[model samples]
Target: MKPELLAALNAERAARRACVVVTRLADGSQRLVREDELVREPMARDTLAAPLAEALRTGRSAAIEHEGEKLFLNVHAPPVKLVATGAVHISQAMQPMARELGLDMVVIDPRGAFATPERFPSVTLLAEWPDEALARMPLDRYTAFVALTHDPKIDDPALHAALRSACFYVGALGSRKTHAKRRERLAASGFAEADIDRIRAPIGLNIGAVSPAEIALSILGEIVAALRAERVAAKAALVP
Candidate 1:
């Protein structure tokens, strides 16, 4: 490989992006492709084209070649964001749990006393209401939104926003009665029952949690369960 190409490949690796290198074999009819640790030798360029295109389309790594040359492609995807829409005590424990799970966490709250860097040292603390704060934060398929405020003024707006977006998880901390009230309010706010149903309310597993830390643990556990279920569903859908 040329120095410039090697440097670019190193840069992409350093950035933790997926990359694929395609090389043409000395025999003009064949090609060699490498992605991560997997390698395919003597593959015709035409034969590899469809899979390569599909991989690139899915933001994955692939390789293709023609003649006696090589090329590398790196797939770079932005890090997923985990937005916790409350700076309450549970959030204090939750943020670190999310970080431990390798998530990029952002804590949002309107109260300065609650949302502080001192409390959430590694989290991106936003001292703004959910509606205002989330307007600046990007919500996508990879994002998880959790409402820990248990306050309509805070949790409602964020929940509403998350429901409208493609956020992977949307959970609100509350009891069964509180969740019923929330459903009513959401229905009144023009959200359909199906949409309101997407929220994991009474938010967390049925672990009978009574303390802040315990509640946080339950919520994170439920989140992991939901994510795993989604992956399973997706995988099942992809099966022949």
Candidate 2:
């Protein structure tokens, strides 16, 4: 890679932005493709849109034939992050699972008693208001946000942030009736019905989860499903 290209790639990596390095297999010529550039550059979109989208979404590098030219797409995507609003038992149970799944876990809660380092020794705990914590660390497309506090003051603000951003998965832990009430509140706050619908209320896979650990497993399972399903959607969109 040229010095300029390497610098650009490093900048993207530092900013946690998704990008791809397209290298021509024949001549060793290479060019950098920022995630936004794919949409703005018509020529890049026409030639490499589908594959580039797949590579970026899946965070996988691949070699492909495009219009008789063999090219390599090296995808650079930030690791997926899970940001939950509560540092409760369920969040504690999710720590190891999140680690094994290679997701960076962050818990934000204003209640210091629940957000103690003693409870979440291995996880990142932010004992600040959800809105304040999220302001410092913005949610992005690769992020999964969950409102586990069951407190509107804490969870609702986080939900607003997540729904406003491009979080891949947004869920809230509650009953159907609880979620219905929450939905009404969000609508009253001016969120669109489509935006409110993005939240998976009664969160987690329907696996009859009874324990905190079980619930954590179900939630992570659902998050993984959403993550991969999005890649599948990206691929499906390219089908002729």
Candidate 3:
């Protein structure tokens, strides 16, 4: 890799941006493709869009033989961030599990009593309001948002921010009736129906969970499902 290419790649990684490096296998030539630039550069984008996007989405490299020209795509994506709002009992169960999955976990709550370092020992606890903290956290496509507070004052604002951003997953803990009411509130607040639909309310997979631990397990399972499901579906779509 050239010094300039490495520098460009490092810059993208620092900015938490997604990119692909295309290599001509025959000659070992290389060029970088930033995700944002794909749309503006039509010829290259049109030829490489499908594989480039797949590489970006899955963070996996791919090789293709197109028009007798063999090419390789090397994908680079930032680490995943899991933001759990509300330092409730479920977080105690979920935090470690999230860490075990290698996700950068941040527990957010304005209630100092709950968001204490003791409550989340060895975890990154942010004792700040959801909106302000999330603004600084800088939610992106690699982030997942979970609202466990069940309090509109806390969870709603977080959802608003996550939904507006490119966060890959958004889940909220609530019953069907509670989510219906929440939906009304969101609609009243100018959120379109589609935006409201983005929330996976009644969060966690349907596993008949009772204890906080069980609920946490279910939620993590659902989050994993959400993360990997799109890649599988997209790959299937490309098949004949």
Candidate 4:
């Protein structure tokens, strides 16, 4: 890698943007394809883009046979981010679990008492309003946003942003009745029915999770399941 390429790669990493390093197995030549540029950048003949896009979407590096040459698509997706729009007990339990799964976690809360380093300890705490905090986060396809606060003032705004963006997963903590009210509120706020449905309410799998820790596990499980399902769907699109 050249110094300039190294710098470019580092900058992309810092920004949490996706890119792919394509290496030709024949001569060992390599090139970088940023997600933003992939649409416009031309590739060598036989190097179809569907596979590369799929790899980046799934964050999986793989070797593909392109016109008899083995070209390795080394995907460099941004770190998966978990932005919890609350500093509640569930967020605390989720913090350690997210870290264990290699997710970059952030806890957001406008309440000073809750959003503190001492209380949450060892995680990034954003003690600002969800609208302000989410505006700063680069919510993308690799990002996951969850509304654990259950307070519309905070969770609603954060959920709106997640729905508007390409964040792969958006979930909220609430019962069916609570989510119905939430849907009404979102509809009144100008979100279409389809858009509002993107939020997985009563979040996590229905595994009878009662305690905060178990609820956290269920939420994480749901998020992972969604991610895996998305990966499968993306790959399935390439099949003839």
Question: Top TM-score: which candidate number?
Answer: 4
Pairs of residues clashing in candidate 2? none
Q: Give every collision pair in model 4.
A: none
lDDT of 1 by residue, 1-240 (tens): 556666766676555344444434343232223343233444434555556555534655434443445544444443556788888899888777788887788888998988878888999999988888778765776678899887899889999899999887899888789999999999999999999989987789889998888998898888777666755677899999
Model 2 scores a C-alpha lDDT of 0.92
Candidate 3 segments exceeding 4 Å error:
42-46, 57-59, 231-240
RMSD of each candidate relative to the true structure: 7.3, 3.3, 3.0, 3.1
lDDT of 2 by residue, 49-130 (tens): 8889888867889999999999999999978899999999999999999999999999998998898989998878899998
The order of the candidates by lDDT, greatest first, is 2, 3, 4, 1
Candidate 1: what lDDT?
A: 0.74
Per-residue CA lDDT of candidate 3, range 18-132, in tens?
A: 8888999999889998988776867354866777877776778878886689999988887778898999999989878988887888899999999988779856899999999
> How many backbone clashes does every candidate have?
0, 0, 0, 0
Q: Comparing 1 and 4 by lDDT, which wins?
A: 4
Models sorted by TM-score, best on top: 4, 2, 3, 1
* Model 3, TM vs. native: 0.85
How close is every model to the real structure, measured as TM-score? Answer: 0.69, 0.87, 0.85, 0.90
**Local error of candidate 3 at 93, Å?**
1.6
Residue 105 of model 3 has an lDDT of 84
lDDT of the candidates, in the order given: 0.74, 0.92, 0.88, 0.87
